[model samples]
Target: MNSSQTEWAEAEFSRGWRLILASAFGVGFGSIGFVTYSIGAFVDPLGREFGWTRTEVQGAIAFGVGLGGFLAPIVGYMIDRHGGRKIALWGLVGVAVGYLMASASQGSLGYFYLAYAAVALLGAGSGPVSWTRAVAGHFHGRRGLALALTLSGTGMAAIFVPPYAVFVVENCGWRVGYMALALLPMVALALAVFFFFPDRSSPGGAAPVHARTLTGFTLREAVSSYRFWLLLASILAMYIGITGIVPNLIPALTDKGFTPTVAASIQSGYGISLIIARLGIGWLLDRFWGPGVAAVTLTSPVVACLILMGEPSYATALLASVLVGASAGAELDLLAYFTARYFGMRNYGRIYGLLYMGVALGAGLGPISFAYLSQISGSYTASFQVALALFAFGGMSILFLGRYPRGDFGHEARPA
Candidate 1:
């Protein structure tokens, strides 16, 4: 190659870390929101287009959460043991494959469910566990922001994917919408692997020599502990309420007599709120008492539920979206930062993987259970009311976390 070409390639490699960071976000935007939350807006439309039932339509989401739940810890362990880039890249490819499979369902909702769920497992391969691990490895000083920014990709996807999905479905047809979602993951995979991946190393620019997972599980020790369960339950409840209950929101709202457009608009606000809240929370988490801040912020959905139950005021709906969105936005950062502080990092993937199973179970149960509840109760009001109480209890429970360790993290002995 010519000298100029060589220099250009060198410069590109110099910018490799930034590219990797952007790739994390890009893949997130392209994959999760598009494939997961945003799929809701098209739920009703796709059901109509393909002659499917609401239960059948929402089944796809339930399946993905369940799949993610089953797979997350394993994927998390892989992330810690292996690395983030390859797993995430493959995950995106799986997501793309899911989208394509859903598109090819020939109007069968069950086909979408099976396809989307398969993609979801692939997605679990590249989910927050992997991304957060990657970012956590790269920055010690900006760990909070780095984690926040990486996880924020899901919210970014949430922002555009739902409304965008609806638009694609309305204009081009449901098949095209699925295809669009399918195709976008290829871009994420390409950017992630080639231009935007991280090196195996530490923040001081020392190459990361892989750490072994600490062995010997002592359930007796784990059960006796208060904070292990505290952090676990806190993170778990947040995941379920946000991922499981919230994604079904627009559909729930529409079932309550709101127009499809209005539902889509509310969903969009939910998406936008996450993007705004994530950056804001990232800034605040560094300065504020994260748990206190979390306590206050986590109550959004309870407040949102109260707002939602009133006479369908657009303002109230907007507030609900904002609260839910903000909670979802900052949640992973809260858990990751807090976990690293309390438990230490050597077993980060292993510890987090186990913790994430709570998330899986909660998330797995929340949607499917809510769908059945929706059927029995004949409205989302009661189900959301129950979720609201859970959010409130969880929000208030943050005060109890005062006894655990806090402050910025540095190198420490791994938890046994």
Candidate 2:
């Protein structure tokens, strides 16, 4: 109301955007840029060098992901108690070192698995769980957009990192490709964490002006609640259907008579659509009900699944890619936004970390499940039908979440 109050509020708003910007870069480079999207680029190279089966080479990643799921809750607790700034900074450095070690591998499966596991541990804090806490702590009215912008980094990385990894691999071999992937997180995440990441419990941390009193369930309470279980189950179901299907997208398209190049271009379209969908979903969330937006987004994948399974054509394939991308784009932004709205930010990091573990589990196992199904059935038709059913179920499940908790913004003090 007063001049001083107005000025302080404006300043905090500006600072929040800066935090989003830095976090965007941190996650883009740290999470997907180097790790998720880039990993596929190395699989062939690794196989070629070690004379290993595809499954054997991919096993290291699967092992790391499995362990990362277990690590999420711990990472969340640390962020709640210690803050994301220190965790991200140290974690990025560790990732860089881990990449270097990976580059120096002696073709030993044990060594490769160990190196990847270390990377998973150090890099845990660089994911959405770490930064979402900070962003949620800083913004509310505009929180959806802030998270959308932050998660856009993954879409950006998906568009560029694979090709970049291939370039590095072609010129310098897989060893150097691993090392090159290290630079983004080492330099960007480190600088961003130092300059922009906030510590909400600290005195000087930038917080939104209209900051509300925190009001919602604690971690124990959240786990005990039926709503939480429903939310988790919905997420798991959706991912189980979506994850395994997307990676085989190109192959599915090509088998329908499309050329490999055409299928590849449509796949690239999926990445571009992710960026557009994130921005669109973010804008909608600020104006509409959170759960509604999520439910609709989740349902889009059902149509995509159908299109892919139906008559094969360039137009149908492209349409399916965009729909799948929309579903993928909505996932993290919805997860971060809904978690804050439903549970509050008191223990946001830890709570989200636990939920994210569900995400990690789906991501790790979904593709494998689809592959196994196809292996047994001798065609992907059965797999696609199952995925379609899961998507519908997941979408409808969110409708029961009811109204998001509202009232206060700051964490309410709990009795010990």
Candidate 3:
């Protein structure tokens, strides 16, 4: 980049660093981070307590996240029209309440599912959709890096939440552990977002001097494009593979004869690799072909799937987790970067919301599918095989996107 371009990119962070920090915190504690990552730690505990099958235990995710996916587009439209601040703040509050409701469940599977659904419904705004929109509104030149930094919050959660959840469940019981998890969003995320996130559309909030003019395809135009459908399918497949594997990694490890603590410790490698991958992919996206970068980074997880097919040692298990984390790291960064590059920010929230619906559904379906398959086959081998194919298909699909359109900020082009 030219010196002028470098300075302009630097200035985005100089002025909007608070926005990035707040977004990262919000995302780390939001439904995707706290709920999605921590649910696995609870699976065995919940089953033991309630005498539920693995499928029954994991079914809550399917119900809750599926409902959340259904609501994502609506929430996106609201974010576009109103701004993300209010929605995110309210959503955080609701997420806290939902966790408390879940803690109160007394062995009723229906009640457990309802509580989780409430968490997803009420916490939708606290997810990546709102925060990424806010960040996208402000940063253009450094959009890829900014998004990677923001999304690294999930990596942070991945690093800390599983082991933390396991510790809490071991000492305080699963109910108290759920209650403790509520504190993350209720306190840290809500406070950071309330104080630091500057939504230009909000009352009295100021836009950055370098904020790009809002431009991009409308939701209708985006949906009609072949690229949009391709991206949606790619996201769906990738998440199915990722979510299916990561959440079950701990249980799978324990099944392979590791203790819960050891399993969680090994999973920490996944989180560390995720954080590194996000930053690395972000840097690469700004400098290379975005689709090519995505293809290479996301397709590496086939190795992880293969590694887990055997009773590997702890060191081998850690390697497998790292590979999985690397792929997980690429997902949201690619999603946000592609949406901005291909669709533009004109209808970003709505468009991204629709795409995020794929993530939500895939996340919801992945765990349940893994559990169901494992239950039927008495092993995770079938699930891993399925995920391997998904990783290959999803990773390669991006190559078909061809080149980005010629335009100022991706606003002036549309697919035929």
Q: What are the root-mean-square deviations of the candidates from the true structure over C-alphas?
A: 6.7, 4.6, 3.3
Which runs in model 3 stand beyond 4 Å of their true positions?
193-195, 199-212, 410-416
TM value for model 1: 0.85
In order, candidate lDDTs are 0.66, 0.72, 0.85
User: Per-residue alpha-carbon lDDT of model 3 for 39-126, expressed as tens digits?
Assistant: 8878988888889887887888876576777788888888877777778777777788888999999999999999998888888778
lDDT of 1 at 343: 62
Q: In model 2, how large is the Cα lDDT of residue 336?
A: 85
Candidate with top lDDT is 3
Q: Please say which candidate is ahead in TM-score: 1 or 3.
A: 3
Displacement of the residue 37 alpha carbon in candidate 1, Å: 1.4
TM-scores for every candidate against the unseen true structure:
0.85, 0.85, 0.95
lDDT comparing candidate 3 with the true structure: 0.85
Per-residue lDDT over 120-142 for candidate 2, one digit per residue giving the tens place of the 0 to 100 score: 77677777777777777776556
Identify the superior model by lDDT, candidate 1 or candidate 3. Answer: 3
Alpha carbon lDDT at 96, candidate 1? 77
Model 3 clashing residue pairs (backbone): none
